[model samples]
Target: MNKYLTLLLLAAVMISCSKPSDIIEQRTFTVSLDTVQVDSKDEILFLNYFLGVSTLDPSQKFLYNLNVRENILEKINLETLSLDTLIQLEREGPNGIGSPFKIIALENGGFVFSNNYTLRYMDANRQVTKQTTLTREPYITDLLPSGKSLSVQSNGISNDGRYLAGLYETSEMSDKPEGIVWFDLENNTGKLIQTQALDFIRENNLTLELEGQIRGGFSTAVFFEPSQDKILFSPTSRNMLMIYDLAADSLITKKYDSKLTSNEQKPGEAKTITDLNEFDKLREDLLKEVTFGEWELDSKTGYRWRFSKELDRTIGEDSLIFKTVVTAIDENFELLGEAQLPQDFVFPYSFWIRDGMPYVFLNIDDELAFVRLKPNFGND
Candidate 1:
């Protein structure tokens, strides 16, 4: 071969073998917000008591909520920014959904609500159609005293409504089964699989102590990915994501670094409430109303809803602290990258994600604010 051609071929081979550092894009999204005003009655009705939000259709035009303190399911027309009644639930009697915790509307006009350990399906006429019981059997072996019972929280139902998943606490750590289960809605059965993520955490000799227990708190967010056939549970106090893959029948854990924009001075560390009594006294002294929030997700990404523990000195008011956080992962639940909320985000908000975009609902000075974070990928 000619010398020039030989050198050129060698250069080409080297170029092909060399790895490029720019594989995944690492970009930060800037937040843009639009505010809307609500009527005086609607504003008064939902003050300091927004449960959670979901959309009726894929268009996400109408957002719905089951009130935190009332047996009422409300809907907000996003286009008009108005709130109206969807249903008024009975809290007692045979037809009652007792002390309801969560409500999910089905496409067929039927609805599902969870009342502690019971899940009831209500027809369009507000009649109880079918019911299912969640038990600790097979998951919990050590029988506790009569009053003591296992802890179970209904997490998320799949988009297709095939599976319902939740977090279950066992009596002891020796059981070794993962503390999460998926209930097959069609078969009316529950199966608990040991996820690989908890195993990885143990294998790596990592410590995840939070709230006086090892991985103690229920994740504020639990997501079911029908596309990937995986369930993701994100604990509020930990820096870990637990994924249960249904197709592979395995559990995987992914951990991310500290990247959230919390108003707390320390982002990831646990805050000490030295005197519980004093804290309660202060709350009574300084606060009129307080609302505890939960998390929801449709697919891979979702919103984490929280309320300010105390008034933000800079913001100068106690507002609902809702923000957006997205996790990018392969089908195997391996973490690729994630993006944090903008640090300077306004407060008193709620949010839901649709079509890779976050729709933030905020209440500032009795007005509703809608914020969105559009993607602008920057290759690295």
Candidate 2:
């Protein structure tokens, strides 16, 4: 009877170990590209730096980009591929959203601007309707030790514009993110949620210090899915996806084994170099490792798409090309498909899926252009 019981336990362990292999099937996808040019009077400055598509627009037609150089909000029509309007923002005064470095489109055609210290909400008429200073928040301030404050970014805003999800760092130089804070915009209340899942970011960071100044390292990024009330915490060094459900107030971590690339990158060691050339060489070597991008959810197909890339060492570091691959996951967090992008395409800071098609920012000889990737999932 004891032998039979031992056999049953072994069978259970084997079944659990083999479940992922049996259930997760590899899929292939064919990708085609189309480039659309943006017709503009003046050259759009920092077009790819920080930009977002209008969530208020059901068709996802408008792309809102913040020109940090000019402090202007450039709204481009994605459907027509034209510059619709540019609203110049003031640096000071009543309607001023002070030195906003990040812009997020709200559900009600409004915008949330973050300057790393304060989050200001602007209405359609360009009026600053609401504002929250992160340093003043007791919930956030109390968490930190003396002489340390939180540097907040507008990571995600809720569908109804009631809650703002912020990713905060301990200091300006800190590459590690402490945790996420969910601020109730209407009530002016906040809740801090910290988890061990984000520890990988600190563990895997490759920091370069020169003359007592930290130079380079990767940071944590967050993606908010309004439809599902989920906040995805993605670290650049690892292939792990951590999802925070607002409704349930729970965090779920998902790790995948990719048949195409390495599952995770090895943690890099911190180095202090005196010469600039040595710093560049070390940075280039670090870039050759697998790094994962933010996961973007496709409303049309209910699938999530994430792009990962490793440096193509064949090309010079000056050229900076990567061997890019896009992986698709279904609604159930199961791996759906993956495809290696064409060599001509570069990894983009601005990318989104419209009608189940992926669009990436492209610069065509100083002009604004976008490359639309039409992916054909063979089974679908």
Candidate 3:
């Protein structure tokens, strides 16, 4: 080998390994958004941490262009997944500093999202159908107790278009929340209901002095059951699910052992038990809407779900069931697949159905691919 050639090869190798973001995996084809710039008139809906992306504008209604130019929210041409038109609400971005998290369409054909600043309920006309401040900053990712519970949320709306679920947070050291409140969109009301979490301190590892329980903070995102009566929500940095009964005006806290990737956890974490009970409860709740549903959970496999409900809300439960397992699968409740993920494979929202399977979005990888799954029996 010539001296010149050796030096050149060494330099090439060094440059190739220099930047981690440049690392690429051939298997992943998930769309990588380039942050199509936004201006005063146009709005761009993009994934913050590998979150989903879309762009919508009012002008789209007046003029038709399959080819998007200077418009956000209007960029879904690859498939039939409808691109929602957010009307009425003024244009905004995530947490008001950057773009918000993912955007999801709703059951009645509208859209829902938190501005990272406040919750918004927009019509298909790109108008502010309704709006309220859900959280201050660092919005908690949540969904409606029922209807379309996307990762993001809007501050307004009930089944009757009257009540709205808003985000609330106090200092981690503030008093443990003794009351919960929500914005009422129908009559334009803000109602605060008393609530509590299941061992708010022990589950969180925070000090709850006799003075008051210190809350980490209020997250805008909370999960809602399919009935639109209950919500499943999480606080910051915790995988535990908090069930809020809206109609009953009560709250229950249940902690699932957080599902950490092999990379995220300390050594031997996988061998340790990961909570699957909360998933079981969610399955029971999901089944009431879907009927005769089934769910199973394995520590390595995560969670499961399959909807026996013919057609009530059509929140895309069928799509999620197959997706949860495509990443990994279990046989007869046993586990398979590696939890260690690529650095870029940022985890997205996930849950399991009891008789069904676990589903997750691996955006940490460059491209986003929806995993659909079927399982084989264990101990064959």
Query: Of 2 and 3, which scores higher on lDDT?
Result: 2
Alpha-carbon shift of residue 146 in model 3 (angstroms): 30
Q: Please, what are the lDDT tens digits per residue for candidate 2 over residues 1-380?
A: 00110000000112244555654233445666777788886755455453442232445777777776677777778778788888788868878878765566766777877766677888988899988777777765775556544444326555455666655666544445666766666776666676555655554344556777766544334454432356665666767677788789888888776655677767654344556777677666667778787787776788888888876556553676677877778787766666666666576654878878777777677677777777666666
Q: Which candidate's TM-score is highest?
A: 2
TM-score of model 1 vs. true structure:
0.60
- Candidate 3 accuracy as TM-score: 0.39
Summarize candidate 1's per-residue lDDT along 239-341 as a digit string, tens digits. 5556667778776666544343332121222222345554454334323221122333434444332222222233435454444344443344443344433
For each candidate, the alpha-carbon lDDT, in order, equals: 0.46, 0.65, 0.32
**What does the lDDT come to for candidate 2?**
0.65
lDDT of 3: 0.32
- Determine which window of 10 residues in candidate 1 has minimal summed lDDT: 2-11
Give the best candidate by lDDT: 2
Better of 1 and 2 by lDDT: 2
lDDT of 3 by residue, 1-380 (tens): 00110000000112255677665322211111121111213333332433233322222211111111222443432123223343222345421212334343544545555443445555655555655554322222242232222223313233333344544334332233333445443444344444555224212222223224332222122333222565444432233345576677666654332122111111111111123454344333323321111222332434332211112233555432211112222232211221222222223444222123232323323333233223333222
